[model samples]
Target: MSEDNPHSSRGSASKTWLERIASLFNAEPQDISELEHIISEAANRQLIDEDTKGMLHGVLDVSNMRARDIMIPRSQMATLDIEQSISEILPTLLDNNHSRYPVVNEDKDHIEGILLVKDLLQFAFDAEAPAFHIRDLLRPAVIIPESKRVDALLKEFRQKRYHMAIVVDEYGGVSGLVTIEDILEQIVGEIEDEHDDAEDADIKKMATNVYQVSALTPLDDFNERFNTTFNEEEADTIGGIVLHAFGHMPERGESIELDGLMFKVSKANSRRLLQLQVISGKPPTATEQD
Candidate 1:
């Protein structure tokens, strides 16, 4: 009989245990927002305890964040060019640790489609063709504007049964690309695949409190591991602050000081800085030199 409604019995039993534990601790288990409404509705009814009401508010604080909250800025995206050969492109494609790469014409701004390495691998083993063109193996790339919400993007990915999107900025230039792995990393954690090189950007731990962190570490992952949580709100990665601190887009090795943190651009391209290093444990002082 319990098998038919297993969760029903389990939940009821758990609630009963919790009610007893509440009594043992001299705590009331009543919901608070309802208590507030009841007190407002009738003068005779006493409201729940203040502590319980405050605790309820804490639970309500954790709502879902937006796409912009965790998006990789357009400058940081790694893309593949269409003209590159199968033999020439394979090393780079494998090194990035990505299974699918966005195929662009001459500029990343003009994404042609998505190329799956798996398709090329089959022909590589067969030795039937002298060379395989990336265009022949690619599927039509899905393009979306930057303003689209992550919730909407996830739904679109599901509906279309696709995993990658070419993000276009307001000017119709390639903004960046977001993958299902990127979205999933936001919740569970970073997901590394076989394509990712083992020695790749894996930070070297120097000290328990002070260690070396990679410039490419996303602000999201860095915050969690270090317990910054960005004071519970801010740019999702350290990279955001570097861009903000410089007052302009930064170049490789351009160092900026903020809140006692020295973010030095360890790696950069003409478009964006690829990596930064956190220099100290203390926050920056106002008089500190740039």
Candidate 2:
């Protein structure tokens, strides 16, 4: 008889338990639906925790999502007017506190180039420095089509070393913008940056039925405060709960109802949920209902 193939046996033994479990089904999932089911099963069997499962799902789904799905809508993008002076631009930059800005001419559609705030540091100390011009400090804008898949764009970003990309429509009109951070958020979750707003913002009751809840509000806290049971194992934040509900990134004005609460995406960008308008339904009572 021939000698045993030790390498083959070693390879089989090296397979992870999860991989072995998956191999019993098939070589690979036929489609996303199957893949989702596999992930669900894995979670149910305690093979992977909910958070890791959710992130793995995100990593898969992000490849199918287009730039428009996650791009910050043009209306929400902070841009610097090319005509504005340093004094005028400083406050705007400070208020928004963004590291980069798309320099524009007369209209937002007319993007000149990107501006890095770090470039302006020189002007802070020397007021008598040569006349400052936005054009002089501009970095070439990386423009991408709205149809571009995030996964492909992420590869391009890594190769090019560009952090931001201007998203354009079919007619070559400026639609919105996407950032490296936005793409990374898909794989690893939110990365708090200098652009983040007040960290202390909390859920506030507006009226009898309506309430404004910050995206950062913990799911447990939300459940306790509202007296509703939205039991979620994967999601910690209200935004994450909503994301899992939709099974994709939801746009502004999109809404979902869960466990007697109506969650409307009141304020959100392509990347993360900012605020949600939650309208409560009747609270549960101890007595049984016929």
Candidate 3:
């Protein structure tokens, strides 16, 4: 047999873009479905360059993020109490885009462990089950120091197959928890699971002068949404603009005034931005801005 494909000539054919890339992946070993999903996502994102692709791959390979890096702060975490019945919480889970919730004893501070919706299903559905403390089904929350890197954490999670890790601050006190999805979002964009409602708006135009947008809004979409003349030659979106404008990477709440548009980083991490505050402005998109 030939070293390469014996049926074809020692050359390439002008197949459509996707088909060619598809050939590069092992259909069985690599899961062609995921391959198609990645390319489709990339195409939808309008990110076709080798550079961005390489950067994305690199970021994903090394989750060099700390617990303070990506954990949804306690204020943002959706949790459950040991007293809350599973029957009452299932609907809440469906609405909150969460597969698991922390089961706290006294409060979230005294988190006993996590309660996965899957594990609680039978109890919620079974009428004969005795009343039990949420603590009964809780799994000890994995705790990691705030300084952990995203890359190493990903490996740890994969090895132990852990889904969540609590982050501790300088005082070694509970800060927040990081989930598998949170780490993955560092590599890719926001990932909505089955629990996400169909009607949630990722980006909402709050008013004629405002937009309550998600942190994960892509650069191109922001450009289109605001009708602003942004320079994407060096970077692709407003988040890119912030990184380039600061002349260094930034964290959440960092602000950069560029051509009357102040990008107040509404959300970010050492990895990248999650959301930005696009100040109210009426700029034309007809010309590029410096």
Which candidate has the highest TM-score of all? Answer: 2
- Name the runs in model 1 displaced over 4 angstroms: 1-64, 194-290
Worst ten in a row by lDDT for model 1: 56-65
Per lDDT, the best of the predicted structures is 2
Candidate RMSDs in order: 13.9, 9.2, 10.5
Candidate 3 stretches with Cα past 4 Å from truth are 1-57, 60-63, 87-91, 197-213, 216-249, 253-272, 276-290
Tell me the TM-score of each prediction against the true structure: 0.52, 0.66, 0.58
Sort by lDDT, best first: what order?
2, 3, 1
Report every candidate's CA lDDT. 0.59, 0.77, 0.64
TM-score of 2: 0.66
Tally clashes: model 3: 8
lDDT of 1 by residue, 1-290 (tens): 76689898899877865564445336553654553343333332333455444333322211133444344445555567888887778766654556788887887778888988788768777867666677888899888776777667777778988988877777888766777655654433345655444334444333222333454556666654544545325564566656766888775446776665566664443334444555667543332222
Clashing pairs in 1: 97-195, 97-196, 215-275, 215-276, 219-237, 259-284, 260-283, 260-284
Pairs with backbone N, CA or C atoms under 3 Å apart (clashes), candidate 3: 63-150, 63-151, 64-150, 64-151, 65-149, 65-150, 215-274, 215-275
Model 2 error, position 205 (Å) = 18
Clashing pairs in 2: none
Residues forming the 10-long window of minimal summed lDDT in candidate 2: 281-290
